[model samples]
Target: MKMMKNFRNEDGFSLIELLFSITVLSVGLLGIASTIPFGYKAIEQSAKRSTAASLLNEGLEKLKGYQYINLIESNFPDEVYGDIPDFPDFARTYEIRMASDVYSSPIPELKMVTITVFWRVSATNEQRIFAVTYIGQRR
Candidate 1:
């Protein structure tokens, strides 16, 4: 009968149980908070890669617009891309060189075009993306 009376009186959690629950909740919240920085970094890197790919495609399209005679006779100039309002951190360049043995015979009628995009991923590390394509005399 005395034990029943004590049990009835203790309808809520003890102080130790309440403190333990609070500590557990705090640790779980902290663990979730720790991942936010890594998620943000991943998102940033993805955006940079997307921008680099777009630049590469644009450079190739401009080169492809030239006619076969003009494209064959001319040399691709080295370009230093800088100071775009949209992509402030990026640097881009491109080059064209004669390719060998594209046909069965050694006429040297083919050309290899390469586009390179670079950026600083961090204070000391650099990141780059390159695209290469072959251009033959237009039919």
Candidate 2:
């Protein structure tokens, strides 16, 4: 009978308990809110990297379409800075050099082609990606 009377009198949580719960919840929400910006930054960086890689691959593919004899530095000289067709923030450049210059044992018909893609992620941050391939006579 005595235990039942005590249980009936304690109908709801005390003021201190309610305050503690509110404080814990607020801290947890603040922690989650603090991480959102970092998550957005990471996703943005990944997207930029993907775009740079695609640009590098596109440049390399175009070079591969040229004839082996035509793969000379005269045809595709090193570019200083060139903008992407539709991507305003990104730029691309390429260099075509003799394989002999880069490799110790190089074939006479081999030419080294390098494609580079670059972009600025922020005022102080820059990102770049590149691809290299050796082209030789088709025969």
Candidate 3:
């Protein structure tokens, strides 16, 4: 009982301490917020790239349905400034050429096919992705 009479207790934070904590918290929040725009931009670019890759695959699949002899440069359709029906922001094209033109030695039985997808990120920024494959005549 004698010790209790001399005890003084201080609990909870002072105003100055509270203010300092709040300032630190606010700075942390602002630092996290600043990166949000860059994250969004990266997500957008990834989505666009995915779309372009899908278009390239679509072109290749279409080619697979044709006869080997029909895989000629003139046989495949090429689009210029042509927007896909579902993806108007993107345009696609493909080229077919003799494989012999690419290889050092003649390979008359093979044809080289290239598919390209194009889009614009900004008025001054244009982007494209392409894939190549070779089709050979069956023995």
Check candidate 2 and list the clashing pairs.
none
Worst 10 residues of 3 by lDDT: 2-11
Q: List lDDT for all candidates, in order.
A: 0.77, 0.80, 0.85
Better of 1 and 3 by lDDT: 3
Q: State in Å the error of residue 130, model 3.
A: 1.2
Q: How many clashes show up in model 1?
A: 0
Error of 1 at 3 (Å): 12
lDDT of 1 at 7: 91
**Model 3 agreement with the true structure over 1-139: per-residue lDDT tens digits:** 8667555354678889999999999999999999999999999999999988998899999998999878876776666555477787888887888888878646677888889999879888879999999888888
Query: 1-139, model 2: which lDDT tens digit per residue?
Result: 9999998798798889999999999999999999999999999999989988887788888886788777766776444334456777787777887788777644886777888888888878778888888877878
| Runs of candidate 3 exceeding 4 Å displacement | 1-9
Task: After superposing candidate 1 on the true structure, give the runs of residues whose Cα lies further than 4 Å from its correct spot.
Answer: 1-11, 69-85, 101-107
TM-score of 1: 0.79
Predicted structure 2: lDDT: 0.80
lDDT of 2 at 48: 87
